[model samples]
Target: MAENPAYPVGLRLTGRKVVVLGGGQVAQRRLPALIAAGADILLVSPEATPSVEAMADAGEITWHRRPYAEGDLADAWYALIATGDTEANTRASAEAERHRVWCVRSDDADAATAWTPATGHSEGVTVAVLTTEARGRDPRHTAAIRDAVVEGLRDGTLVAPHHRTRTPGVALVGGGPGDPDLITVRGRRLLAEADVVIADRLGPRDLLAELPPHVEVIDAAKIPYGRFMAQEAINNALIEHAKQGKSVVRLKGGDPYVFGRGMEELNALAEAGIPCTVVPGISSSISVPGAAGIPVTHRGVAHEFTVVSGHVAPDDERSLVDWASLAKLTGTLVILMGVDKIGKIAETLVAHGKPADTPVALVQEGTTAAQRRVDATLATVGETVRTQEVKPPAVIVIGEVVGVGPRTSA
Candidate 1:
């Protein structure tokens, strides 16, 4: 009898039983996706890799810790035959056939009832590619095609040339340091769909050049502001553009909620009944220091790290930071936008009780082509900043953890 062709369908297997007859590398690779789909998996392998054992110990899956048997697929909605022993796989497949459950064979695709396709998602679209032709059965070939399509959709090339049905709303995107590649996949997709982009000075600027020419790009630095109502003017611009039925993207440097005044924009949008979406970007604080070979927190060297804004001097009346309390911390202290006031900040911390000789690393333009670092003690960082000419948008790490990574000093 000729075998029936395999059909592809997405299974909503939440809370359903799935029997897996392997405990090797292939099983490890497939388990995470099934777990993510909320499937109840039963593993019938005697010995497993450390990662699989860890998952079982963590209560992620039910591990039988033994070989497969006739009744293994009795209550399973689906079964997978992936063991090295051909007899074991044959037994499992027979049991699945008797139970009328779909079985997938990793060793022999021709003998399997189901085949897993290479899958990816772009925005609300889910892409699943399967090879039906005789020469297209290679999983590697299928995955390569899938990745190319996903990348095209991400970078905006696959999208339609005309965006006629664009949504009128606001998207606050974090550009993630200065490298264009560091931006999130979702963020890149949104940029392709944007009609208007209001970008900041410190955000990823390279991506703006790649956007379609029809897309309006506005530099936030060039936007005129009122004396004390600059934020208000910016908020008005977003609302005005959205009301005109244009999708607006307010692209900032790092995470919008973290000192980016994202909450203020959200509140303003809510007040005016405008729709808004926020996409988070990797902050330069941790990533920049890391690029400069400095760990903010090391296992035994330091246990915690705090990221603070140093735009205001410690003695200034408008400064809300409790500099006195910061000096008492025994962990890492990361200061952003404090290059100009490094001298005052260092003096304040030293006076309040922090060690004068604590290691301080200033990572400038981190994670970018022009990234550079300068090292000094808390007592001498202000002078070192002057001598080395460390520029703005730098991350300063003040703690013992700075010595944990290689090249702590520039």
Candidate 2:
């Protein structure tokens, strides 16, 4: 800490003039925050990076297309002097000082009247960290600290319960495939804030352990043809928790809407007069195969990829998927929740004119430490799965694209 520390403040630069004397990387980085603050930015530089030029082209900032002039900072509320030239930057800094404009110098922080803090935003909160020059002015260290704070706040590890406004409602959050890190930032944040979390067996199960002890975590283990919580019971739990003025999060694996029956839960919440926020996750149909180094659609191989739920057999009367039509298409087929019925699924496709020798790959527990890929042909997939003991929550890719990329197996 310095004897005389710089006072930290938030600038409301909306509709205010902010002059920038550079178009290099530094200016390119700083301009976005200025634009986001609704600042009327004026950039003066003979040449700029392509990204900076694109911003000027998009009318986000005004480009002077010349060197900085003396009057550039005349009416500017703030200025950024980042022109690499020593003399030019010094001149712009002087001009800004004469006009009583606070200026940040990228090349020389000690000489600058103002310093930009390492900043991060989470939800509606803005986190800014500034270190005194006396502390050696380590931007990297400050940035690291900023990241730690932001992540803690986002994951709910650091919480100021009394300071936050708790909105009691239900959020249908897609936890994404099986990896804990695959969960969306919004979904993770809601989970961190949840008073009650009703989780599915499939999604990032590890995240449940991270929840605070006060959080009631219900295992809505809707396992296929097994002991599980009923849909109605899950809905009632969500409604009941929310009615008690507690925040509820219904966390499901992969995308909630993509065969996760998310709509049913959402509809139930709506009927109960409970507000619901739907946060979509990365669906396993595409991501799982990709994680196993298989592209669902590769150029000159597969132009289209179709995602179909294999929970029910293709020959089942209740099945909505047209396996006959799918077999006719010269594209990729991504099947989710079809491990047990894969033999029947493959037989139906083969019977529908799909070649028995077509390539097939099963990616199990994709994007997680337990992830593994098994390769086979449409004809051999059923036997291979049975012999290998392939389990539920695996994504089966059937197409030429499966053979396109380098095979990765556990």
Which candidate should be chosen as best, given TM-score against the real structure? 2
Where is model 1 more than 4 Å wrong at Cα? 1-116, 151-166, 226-228
Q: List the residue pairs that clash in candidate 2.
A: none
- The residue-level lDDT of candidate 2 at 342 comes to 92
lDDT of 2 by residue, 259-280 (tens): 9899999999999999999999
Q: Among all windows of ten consecutive residues in candidate 1, which has the lowest summed lDDT?
A: 1-10
Please identify model 2 stretches exceeding 4 Å from their true place. 1-3, 44-59, 62-72, 84-99, 152-162, 222-229
Task: Give per-model TM-scores.
Answer: 0.76, 0.88
How accurate locally is residue 121 in candidate 1, as Cα lDDT from 0 to 100?
75
Instruction: Please give the RMSD of candidate 1 to the true structure.
Output: 5.0
What tens-digit string does per-residue lDDT give for candidate 1 at 194-263?
8899888988998899898899998877778767477887888899899999989999997788788989
